[model samples]
Target chain A: MPFIKVRDDLCKGCKLCITFCPKQVIRMSDRLNPKGYYVAELFDKEGCTGCGICARMCPDVAISVYREDKKEVPA
Target chain B: MKVVYERPESLLDVPFTYCPGCTHGIIHRMVADTLDDLGIRERTIGVSPVGCSVFAYEFFNCDMVAAAHGRAPAVATGIKRVHPDKIVFTYQGDGDLAAIGTAEIIHAAARGENITVIFANNVIYGMTGGQMAPTTLIGQKTDTTPYGRSVEANGHPIRVCELLSSLDGVAYLERVSTHDPKHVLKAQKAIKKAFQYQVDGKGFTLIELLSTCPSNWGMNPLDSLKWLEESMLPYYKPGVYKDIG
Candidate 1:
């Protein structure tokens, strides 16, 4: 399944990623980073299609999306 | 796993200093991504302007020069002329570009300098606190215009793309927004094209990005995006104002 990684230290909790995620997979976590801002987390891993929209909308460049490559798998 | 989206190598690992929800980070990433995609990061020299993005030199991985207030275009011109092979670009905000540096930008475009300019228009002066800017909308309340900007007092918002388009030296000019993901993608495309034009030795290229200043605008990050779409979009219609190739 495709998934995303959020850099907690870099996330400013602006929620742009949460707002733009078409799948509603991201949410603001109760925990705050060292900077005292809430960081975004992937709540529904299965719902994400790894479209990378969150990464694109992220102003902090804190999100990165990854997906399994089918082409590299054995036929 | 294959990486679908990650930070571009052209950007430094440091977190941006922009306030929470500010769109400068997004525009910075797009420019860095363009540098990475064009494989010109090593040969690229960026001119950092005054305002909120003054520290842009520290964020971008390539060589950077901090220009005097509103002198980014002039600085970029000198750099491009000295190193014709190097891809030179200037990152400037509205206050720096449309206000103090108006003469520099206009003359650079008029001269058809082989350089790229990334103009960020947030309607208000971001760094020095929210004040009336050259691009400030009519009836928009800012620190200077508490009651809202008035045509009789502030005149009208300057449309940089429209003004620069008429110059024969311009090779490409486009105005884009960053209110949504779709528009952000379009902005990236426009940025990449502008850089491509520079690489091809085309005359001056500029891409105007409609950006947001959440802190100065006194709105949450999400609300600022909404404000940009609702208030800014109608006045600054996003589209290609000029393109030579």
Candidate 2:
């Protein structure tokens, strides 16, 4: 039940993360960001294992992943 | 929800301005993560060098200072000597380090200055429009070397790790590449070790990072990475050149 989020503004559409995702859960979007780069988007959330490889591979640090078992306490 | 992976706290919240597919951002994040993990973010000080990483002062969360071209080692040495307790590092590129700053870095290392250095070798000078650097290999075409690097005109590429391996003042010197994920992981580990050496008051630790300049190399990001694996690794083999206690 891991999840991934892409900060659209931060992503420069290099798509380096898409290639690094072991589960092939990410893909380039048809839409473009303000910076004119085609940002990455999730193709299949169910296929994600929350490996965080995309996060590590991202040059912009735009990807964040949260594992299913970990719950955050209320701030 | 628990965040499994996010930007390191040691880096600013602003976006990096490096060119698309530039590996500088990744290296910055790895250094920031290492500092945060070591609990030395507040005590760390970095010297921003000339070249592509000149704007490093803005990206790193800790205190930072800018230095003249190839003068980062001198500036970092001054900072560390004035504040011995603070962790000091200089971020430099091939043109800045192996070329112009050669004298400064060699003297600093020979003196056994307790500081860490992050050396990025992208083969060509990225910021100045892809000129030939000291680390540019033969047969490589750059802005200056349009036809190709001619051995008769240009000397062979300088291997930084091998050059500094014999220095008694150097506590650690390792070369790592970022062309692939496995190598990137290893580079991060080497970066961590290089910084930790400084934390332990070890002298003159440097990690030469082999990186890509897709825009300058005249290839797409993917192809540039492939070219690096095929062409660069043979000359600048990655491994621990020296890791003396």
Candidate 3:
């Protein structure tokens, strides 16, 4: 599974990620956090490619991207 | 398989928009490569200025802000103040820094803003159609200086690193160029040192990059690089003006 995390407090709400993501998995969350800036959220993880576009586009260094890889064991 | 020199992991795979043979691309690559090497990409916030590199906000692949005109230093100050723990730097061009934003840079250094400034001094206003800039050589001609810059009228080019090193607030200052591969590597080292100073909680740091504007200079890319080596480097030699470390 691939997941994206946004440090809500650090987000400046530049909206650059929305424009750069190829999967369009990211969108401005409807709810405004305490900072009054719209936080970025992943609308669908199934479409995420773990390309790390959202993390790259963030101007505040507020996001982190992670992907889980499973190693198969010989039966 | 042969090894390839790939783009830095800190930089996106997107192609740059700079003109062919423009040194901004080289400097940008150096900065990105340095960030990747230092493992600071995740904590970096780059402030892009208004000049040929104005769209640097797109190229860095890190958190970046667009500063008005030459006010990158001012914007960077705010970002650094709010997030003192985060690494902050500014990418600026000659017209953006030395011409319109000179006062801002000077004050930022004087105040010891604890940020890195990557100043690309191409000696002409590139984005605005190649106007004579503060760093333009004494006899260099541009759109604004049709008959070449007269020393009596335009004055001599400002030695920014030399001037900034004289200040007590600045912890590091270096002038470098990207007209050649060897010098490109040297400039990269200087840029890395500037960022390292800020990360170490040292005061202000600035790296003046002597870049080439081939399209604006009306010369082919190779010729422009040659001119930069034979003419520009002679006037603006590369060196570390100040390094506390």
Candidate 4:
């Protein structure tokens, strides 16, 4: 399964990722960062195909996407 | 796990100072990604302009130089001339490029300087509280043009890519926007191409990005993106205006 990690300290809560994500996997969380900005979180983990559009759209570079390595899987 | 997307190595770990939803961070990442993709991060020297991105020196992991307001092209020219083997690039905003540093950029392109310029045109001066820029469209309301820009008073908005297209020295010129993911991806490709041109010894490649200034534009991030698409796109068409390669 693919997943994204959001760096809470870096996110400005601009919601750009939320706006541009085709899967609508991200949303502005109620929790605020140290800067008082409500950071975005991955709300729909199953919907994320790990396309990385949110990471690309993120101005703060707060999101990092990771996917399972097929080559590392046991046969 | 395999890392699919993350911060480019050419960018430092420090946070950007741009306002929330400001596209400067996006543009910076694209440039950094290009530097990393070209494997020129070690040999790349970036010239920071005096605008909202004035602190760009601190963000890019490569060697950076701070130039006088609108004088980034001039400084980049000097660096490229001295260190021809090193890839030199200038990151500038509208007020810095189209307004005060017009002569520097024009002459640099006219002289066929081999340097990459990432010109971010947000239509308004973001650092200076939404002042009208040379690229500000007519009827656009800015701090300086509270009643909307008038052609008679503000003259006319400068079309930089079109203006520089006729220059014989220009190797590549493209105008792109970062309003949506699709456009942002295209803009990234344009940035990579401009840097590739520089690596190939092509002269004077510039990628003009239509950026958004949400704080200065007095709109939320989403609204500002819409405004950029609806208002700025027709005036500054997004396409390759010139390509010699």
- What part of the reference interface contacts, as a 0 to 1 fraction, does candidate 4 reproduce? 0.83
Q: What is the lDDT of residue A71 in candidate 2?
A: 43
Model 2, residue pairs in steric clash: none
Residues forming the 10-long window of minimal summed lDDT in candidate 1 chain B:
B1-10
lDDT of 3 by residue, B27-129 (tens): 7877897899889999999999988888888878899999899899999999999999999999999888988898999999999999999999888999889
**How does each model score on TM-score?**
0.98, 0.97, 0.75, 0.97
Better TM-score candidate (2, 3)? 2
- In Å, candidate 4's interface RMSD is 1.0
DockQ class, candidate 4: medium
| Descending-lDDT candidate ranking | 1, 4, 2, 3
**Residue range with the least summed lDDT across 10 consecutive positions in model 3 chain B:** B1-10
Which stretches in model 4 have alpha-carbon errors above 4 Å? A69-75
**What DockQ would you assign to candidate 2?**
0.65
The DockQ of each candidate is 0.83, 0.65, 0.02, 0.77
lDDT of 2 at B40: 95
RMSD of each: 2.1, 2.9, 12.3, 2.3
In candidate 4, what are the lDDT values of residues A29-62, reduced to their tens digit?
9998889998899988887778888888898988
- List the pairs of residues colliding in candidate 4: none
CAPRI quality level assigned to candidate 3 from its DockQ score:
incorrect
By lDDT, the best candidate is: 1
lDDT at position A38, candidate 4: 89
